[model samples]
Target chain A: QQQVKQSPQSLIVQKGGISIINCAYENTAFDYFPWYQQFPGKGPALLIAIRPDVSEKKEGRFTISFNKSAKQFSLHIMDSQPGDSATYFCAASKFNTGKLIFGQGTTLQVKP
Target chain B: EPEVTQTPSHQVTQMGQEVILRCVPISNHLYFYWYRQILGQKVEFLVSFYNNEISEKSEIFDDQFSVERPDGSNFTLKIRSTKLEDSAMYFCASIGASTDTQYFGPGTRLTVL
Candidate 1:
């Protein structure tokens, strides 16, 4: 079973537009949600993270809006740029579990 | 910034051969983990190690697989007999004492023929 589900396998947005990716998880034990960005032939890098305690967290131009009761979270990129074109993965994990359950992934393309 | 380092960016091994992948985690990190990603697939967790012992592992980690912290800084994963299905990109990650964020290595592309 896929523990976490992501929507819009691919996305395209114009520069200065907002790009969004959403993910949902079935396990309530998940307390930490993180978004990772991966470029071709490279490892995934941490983009932003949020705990269940907060409904929203923002870092730079990236923001994570989490709804604990709905078991859903979404990543929003403001003013999307061509450099933002990459694959994004949303992950969930229980505290101290040491392992993350990752979503299928979303490929984003920012057209200049 | 300190980052995890993995050896041999790519390895091509024959079937039924034993292969060991090595990783050197950050100096102050306490948790180490191994994950794999098949082509165009989501990253899958293999195992997690802490304090020289395994803290968690996934179902995909079978008897043919084993992990060891041979020294203070080196963590290794061994596959007793590799199969064609083992071909994938293996990534090593480490987390420090203060944060839950994991820093990942560039990954070693293992090709089992």
Candidate 2:
């Protein structure tokens, strides 16, 4: 029930294109969802997050669309750039426990 | 901006040896956690600490693993006997009063041979 499944395993996009990654969870107990971006040999950095309370959230060029009833959420990177090329992870956790269950990261490669 | 810090960017130990990974969480953050990721795998939660005690732990935490907040600032994960499978990137995370947002530190790469 703690699983947060994400897809596709790998993504390729051209510059100035929109890149979208989707995730779904089986655990309804999860009230907090966050997306992380990680470069090679570094830790995951917070990208953007959304909760069940809101359907969508936008942070600069990154946006998160959440569907509470469907137990689904997605991260969209607008005007994808080579700098945005990295492993993106979708995580779910309960507010009280704060133990994040991460998805099988999606590696995004934005071609120059 | 305050962030979590970890020591010994890399550690190499022989099988059966003991290893400890240390972390200094963000000041004023009340909750701390430990997680691990094997090469090319998803990050897995090991444990969570609060108020100088373990608030929660995962099955992977097992008897060989332990956590401590010896001082007010440093949080540590100790593996009494390192196994070959224990080699992974261990991460420390913290959540402040918000109870939702968690900040992760640059992980300690443990290589058990």
Q: What is the C-alpha local distance difference test score of each model?
A: 0.94, 0.94
Model 1 C-alpha lDDT versus the unseen true structure: 0.94
What's the C-alpha lDDT at position A95 in model 2? Answer: 86
Per-residue C-alpha lDDT of model 1 across residues A45-89, encoded as one tens digit per residue: 999999999999999999999998899999999999999999999
Model 2 chain B lowest lDDT segment of ten? B94-103
Regions of model 2 farther than 4 Å from truth: none
Docking class of 2: high
Clashes of 2: 0
Residue B112 in model 2: shift from native, Å?
Answer: 0.4
Most DockQ-accurate candidate: 1
lDDT tens digits by residue: candidate 1, B12-109: 99999999999999998999999999999999999999988899999999999999998889989999999999999999999999989999999999
User: Lowest summed-lDDT stretch of 10 residues in model 2 chain A?
Assistant: A40-49
